[model samples]
Target: MLRFASLGSGSKGNATLIESGVNDKDTRILLDCGFSTKEVEGRLEKLGRTAESLTAIVITHEHSDHVSGAGRLSRKYNIPVWLTVGTSHACRDNDFYETHFINSHADFEIEALNLHPFPVPHDAREPCQFVFSDGASRLGVVTDLGYYTPHIISHLDKLDSLLLECNYDERMLLNGTYPHSLKKRVHGDKGHLDNKHASELLKKLDLNQLKNIVGMHVSEKNNTEEYASNALCEGLGCEQNAVSLASQAEGFSWREM
Candidate 1:
């Protein structure tokens, strides 16, 4: 069987571990490394894993919350890292670890997982999200995104599971306490996915094959699990509980199609 879990996910840090294997082969990959090396190890230990269990690390962007610990982890564990050329340039000057680059637009395979890194509109040197498959079920992870592009919707159609961002509630953000500048950044074209916009994006996707839908990257002050899940449920025509929220502490549990 193929399964995955998040070590943690949020504004502070983010990491996802995916496992696929049966019989003679097993592969464990970390999607991002936002935590410090020891912190990542602790998180992994919480999930019954360790640093040596990971086959490689893949980064989505250069944001500190996504790449902060990536460099250190790779160096400590001597693991290969995959990212985009632009992302490489952004990190290269920093003497982090042994790294490799991939075209964000290309599709590649690693063991039993088919990996696809698609570009997204986020304020970074080069940011992309991922789609992973074990030849049967597909898991699409889209977070830290600004707006929903048609390409994203089309690519995410019929996914078995999705980890989509629902960063903030528009109303809360508009009326909340953030500075005017930060607020504008969060609401801008490359800011983040607001709850309402996330809901609208869900409406455009084909959820026929969807079994688990995760609302990720929620803002602590501007959003709530209740609000995000309810909005996505409504948009996807699913029950409230049918939609899950990936918390800052524990992202979510492993789910099957």
Candidate 2:
């Protein structure tokens, strides 16, 4: 069996837990450690997990909200960390327990799980997302992309589940209090996805086998759970409750695949 959950998601912090296989093949991978090591441990406790159970921590980028506690978490737990060479360089000062430089275009294995890392156009150094498989199922996660590309679309196609960014509502973002430059960056090609475009991207994907669809990393200032979830629901041609929303605090519970 394969399943996943979120420790937290949004601007304040971000982390995801993916677990696959069973018994000796059980592989637990933490996708990002955006919060402090202490906070991550507490959150995992709520989900019935501990740092020692983790097989590895795979970093998406070096942004504070994506990588802030990765090193400390790895060091405390004696878990290996895998990240792109450029992202590792950006975090050179961090003292990790173990480090494995990865390539954006490569596929790798961590015990029972297979991970396909792909580059994304986020502003952070060597940002990327991942597609995970446990032989029988596939799960795609994309949170920090600036914009969607054909290459990205290809990776996300035909998945069993997806955790996608619904960072902002375009109008709300444009009208919010962020400065003009900051606003541009959030909506730019190297920033994040607004509800409208996120919905559009969902429509382009093949969702016949999709069991779960979550709109993650929503903006507290620029979006509402209703707006973000509704947009995703519309694209998927499902009711509002069919779409799950991940908030900065109290992220949704585990969903199995």
Candidate 3:
């Protein structure tokens, strides 16, 4: 079985825990480690896991909120970190357990899980998203991208589950307290996906095989759960409650595919 959960999500910090396989052969991959090492340990304890149990850590970019705890966790547990070369260099520190450079368009594996990385438009150096498979089910995670493209759609097609970003509401972002430059950065082409854009991307996907949808990277200041849920559900043609959201605090429980 392939199951995934988030330790936390949002600008403050983020970590995604995905597990596959059974018993002694299980493979646990962390997509991003954006918290303190101790904080990650505490959160993992909530899900009955430990940093020592992780198989690897895959970083999407060098953004602080997405890589704050990566080096420490990898060093403490002796797990490998996989990311593009640009992303690796952009990071301020290099004190990690081990670092593996990956191609944005390539596919790789770590025991039981296969990963496909696709380039994304973000302000960071060489940002990308991920899709994971255990040979039976596929989970696509797309966050921090400013917009979607046909190339992205092609990769996310036929996903069993997706964690898409719904960073802000259009009006709220324009009218919120963020400074002009900050607001522009968050709303620009290399910024984050707003509710409407994320919803539009969902509408273009093939959801015939979709079993789960989770809204990720929501802005606590410029967006609300109700607004995001309503927008995404409208595209999925499902009830608002059917789409679960990852919170900045508790994230969400694991869901199997």
Per-residue lDDT, model 2, residue 167, is: 96
Off by over 4 Å in 1: 92-96
Model 3 stretches astray by more than 4 angstroms: none
lDDT of 2 by residue, 161-221 (tens): 9999999999999999999999999999999988888899999998899999899999999
Sorted by lDDT (best first), the order is: 3, 2, 1
Give the candidate number with the greatest lDDT: 3
Global lDDT of each candidate: 0.85, 0.91, 0.92
For 1-257, candidate 3 gives per-residue lDDT tens digits of: 99999999999998999999777568999989899999999999998888889999999999998998899889989999999999999987657889899999999998989999999999998999999999999999987998888999999999999999999999999999999999999999999999999899999999899999999999999999999998899889898889988999988888989
TM-score of each: 0.95, 0.97, 0.99
Clashes of 1: 0
Q: How well does candidate 3 score on lDDT at residue 6? A: 95
